[model samples]
Target: MSTQPPRLPPPAPEDAAARNMRLLVLLRWLAVGGQLATILIVHYGLDIRLPIAPMIVVLAALVMLNVMTWLGHPHWPVTNFQLFGTLACDVVALSVQLYLSGGASNPFVSLYLLQVVMGAVLLHAWSSWALVGLTSLALGLVAWLSPPLALPPWFATTLSPVYVIGLWCNFVLAAVLLVLFVTRIAANLRSRDAHLAAMRQRAAEEDHIVRMGLLASGAAHELGTPLSSISVLLGDWKGEAAIRADPRLAAEVDEMQAEVMRCKTIVSGILFAAGEVTGEAPERTTLRRFLGGIVAAWPGQVTFEDRLGEDRGIVADRALAQALTNLFDNAAEAGASAILLTAKLEETMLVLTVADDGSGFPAAVLAALGRPYNTSKDRRGAGLGLFLATNVLRTLGGTVQARNRPEGGAETILRLPLVSLALEGSR
Candidate 1:
């Protein structure tokens, strides 16, 4: 039998574009606020005779554009072309405002650089350069066509104290915005990279599990013949007249047969886990009965509690049963005198918890839980129980959590969607 991990799909470009579009919308709102404050200060505070009506019209148009973009954002995927168009609109709006104020002579004309920087960060090469060309053209048109601003005699020239102070303010605003927006964009990129890295790690772990399963399946196949031969020999000895006459001999033969049968059952489980057809159909049973069987079969001092109100029908999943057994084995190895198992249904999920009155997990083992070979045992190939259990639950769209109780001992919790094991047509 062979198996492979499910491949993870790469993130779509539209995802990043959509996120950047949101940033642009936020920046646009900031632009509106800044533009309004600047317009009011220049026209009223500075006593500058400016084209207030037309500039206000431009501001209103920007506000309406932002509103439309916000409303349509969820309905459509944002694309590179759309982002380019948004930047272009801002460029035109800024050009008109600059033209109304003082054309290229306006101190805030440097704001064009902010848009160019944003484009380079958020756009593709072609779009970034296109924005550059568009901004350059707008700058030239404003310089050539805009009417001169009627400034006070003291502030008439570009070298006036008030004009130099305006340039200083423009520099400050540009610097602040660049820092804010660029840092946020970088954070978005970093988050995407981290998510991709995690996906890669999970793929690698699943591949390792596949290889291990193949090896185990091959070993089980090789052991099957010898185990069957031994079983036949044990049966023959049990039937012998001498052994039947001797109670001690008969008891010994019976014990050997039982052990051999247990070994065969374990091999069958291995084959089943490898995705091989076991020549037997899965047993259909209710959740309550399934849990009861596992508890009754466990050869240990254990308690079982089922708080799952109404019973639901499900297929008997041998792999899941084996995973639970692995947890029980671990508890036994930890010197647990008694183990407690609890089951409950939380909406569509089945929640199971196993707790042991043994020494809690070591800090290092707890920290690296679910990782192969991460165990406190000094024996070779130890610590695979929890690793395999974790992977099995994960394959069924479930998760396992391990923690030490404050009072004492350790607890492991398993949660899986009941739909994964639900019988067909059984709610």
Candidate 2:
């Protein structure tokens, strides 16, 4: 994650969707390939005709499907019903082989357990247990009611009842239990996968929105220069007032000037937050000295306090200092004469916290805090502060969250990937 982009242009939404789909496809195929290789070794290398041949074929076909999907071939993935369909075909195949080989006493008669487990993994709870029931019934009926064929070249003349009972206990009961727990594991996997997909989607969408805001901010900045020039000319003309003293005209003109100035300020803030204009990277600043430097630079009236971890540190990008400064300024604006800051290392993550005893986020701005066009800063361009902070952190493989403290103040928590801390430590 530390190796992650210091900045990223949010990827297109379509890429996110495709990426999730591909992950599932890859996982499915990997499972199929492993299973098939196991089968090939069992059948060819060992000459054991354990009646797993049909399942081996199934695994092989699944591998092919996975490969095709990965190679840009699109088809619905193997859903529960498809898994069931494959098993149903296998059941028919095995049933015929059972009749030809040795009926219920055949060692391979236990392979129905495989189908039961597979079904359990993909189906809902009720459906999974139902599949288990159906499998038991089918295998039981085949053993009980169906006629037994002659034993194979290596099997018994006739099957003993004890042998059949033992087979049932070993294969059937174990299969049932296997399906039960495997279903649980698979269900958890499905839920976890869903959660991961949702998280990625959120990150992707957030990235996209931020990129759009950046573009809009850039445009606003470009527009600001001309708007400011026009505003200055309007102010100069307003002094003359085309023969002096139309109260309505003067008020309207003043409103226009204010609006123009607002646009200009907003654009300037955008440029600043974007790091569009920056001085050379200052002599490499470590997390501790850099932040200390920031506090040192704060105005005398405000107490800019900071603490850093012994192990965790940041390289302190030239622009990153400004980003951190913006956060401190926000604290100052909140009427805080003093700000408390602390940095800590937790394993591979660096957490930076900033808190102001001053008033928490104002009620009006609380709802839209990180949104690009909103800011509590009364000045026009102040909205870009949080956005700039967010983008900087994001680019650094980190996160920033703003929340009002339950007791009284606002807190902004910044988390950076531990990779940066690791890099700093190694140095």
Candidate 3:
């Protein structure tokens, strides 16, 4: 049994894109800071003569772009193309800044590699490769057209100790940024993959439920004829003179008739749940009355607690009712003599909890609670009750969770939106 905690549903593609965009915006702000620091240190601290005016204008434009992106990101739909465009803008800004300083001679020219790496991770394949081409072209153009930097005599040559130190500093900055942003991007991709896997698992479970429902419906239809025949035979026997004269025989006939009627009821429920029978309208009742009815029908020692201060009208869902009944049955089968059921309204949700003094579920069963045939019971077809119940709740956009209580017993919780069962016009 795996003890992994439950995971929240995956975010939509747009949500993921929005998050990635925010990451880009943050990276841009960091770039702005790093560029400002390097420009100041070189122009003032190192006594290098740089074209400060035009470079400041480019830095200002980059700042404005970051501001606009941060403000407008949530208003528009985010997409791969949008991500590609954002990265392209960053590349353009970087190239312009480099052209102003020393073009390709600036050790910071290596920073173009950082943009390419980001594109590879965040953009579509074609866009990624296009960014590669764009960066390569920008580098060549800057090298060809820009004026040479007015460096000190000691730093004039590329192999000078001062030039070597500048290159080393640029390498360290690029390496740190890469480690920070790339890891975050990788984490986002992993999250998206996990969500996709969860969706696939849910699709598979739903398919399995459909197949089982069809089989159960067909079985019910076949059993209808034999059950009807037996009911008619018992009716005749009850009316016969010999059986009527013997009170004991008549009593036994009555018991048999009751048993047959119970079996017929079970078959009808199966058909109804499968949508094979839909002529009758759904029953409508109050929440309190509906739960009370279930408890009254169960032939066991059960306690009901209604923490819902006010009752709301609801369309009685027989499937939901049966699902709760299955929980009770499981409790009894697990050697529980007494069960406690509680109902309450939490915000817009309806919550029901069942706690029992039964031997709690085995660790393996708890680990694979909703998966079909994942049961501790040794008998054939013993696990379908919980499986069917779990699926029923899932169909209603609810979930069922079970765990062993530390005090010695098991607890199962069911939660669903109240709107799923609320009566029309009864808010």
Best by lDDT: 1
- Per-residue lDDT over 1-427 for candidate 1, one digit per residue giving the tens place of the 0 to 100 score: 8899999998655577888988899999999999999999989999988888999999999999999998998789888899999999999999999989987578788888888788878876677768777876776677668778889997785545465456545544554465457656766888999999989989988999999999999999999999999999999998899999999999999989888998898899899889898797878999999988888777777799889999989998888898998899999999999899999999999999999989989999989989999999999989998898899999999999999989889999999999999998874
* Clash count, one per candidate: 0, 2, 0
- Stretches of candidate 3 exceeding 4 Å from the true structure: 1-162, 245-248
Displacement of the residue 380 alpha carbon in candidate 2, Å? 12
Q: Which stretches of candidate 2 lie over 4 Å from their true place?
A: 1-119, 122-159, 173-192, 195-203, 206-210, 213-217, 223-303, 309-339, 344-350, 357-391, 401-406, 417-427
- Listed in order, each prediction's TM-score against the native is 0.64, 0.43, 0.62
Candidate that beats the other on lDDT, 2 or 3, i.e. the better one: 3
Q: For residues 1-427, could you state the per-residue lDDT of candidate 3 as single tens digits?
A: 8898999899765677798999999999999998899889999999998888988888899899999999999899889998999988988988898888877678788888888788767776667767777777776677667677778998884444465456545544554465457656777888999999999998998898889889989998999999999999999999999999999999999999988997887787788889876466778899999999888777677899999998999998878888888899999999998899999999999999999999989998988889888888889978877787788888888999999999988999999988999988875
lDDT (10s digit) by residue, model 2, range 1-427: 3676588788744533344445556656555666566556655675545457556565566666656656762444444554455456545555655554456865567667766765665555776677777766667667776565433366436667786667666666776788778877877888999999978866875886568668866796668778968987887869984625887878888878777775564565456555565233435446667667766655434343444446334454544565677788887777876677777666667777887777887665657555575665567666766776777787778888888888777888888885653444464
Clashing pairs in 2: 6-395, 348-418
Shift of residue 181 alpha carbon in model 1, Å: 2.3
Q: Is candidate 1 or candidate 3 better by TM-score?
A: 1
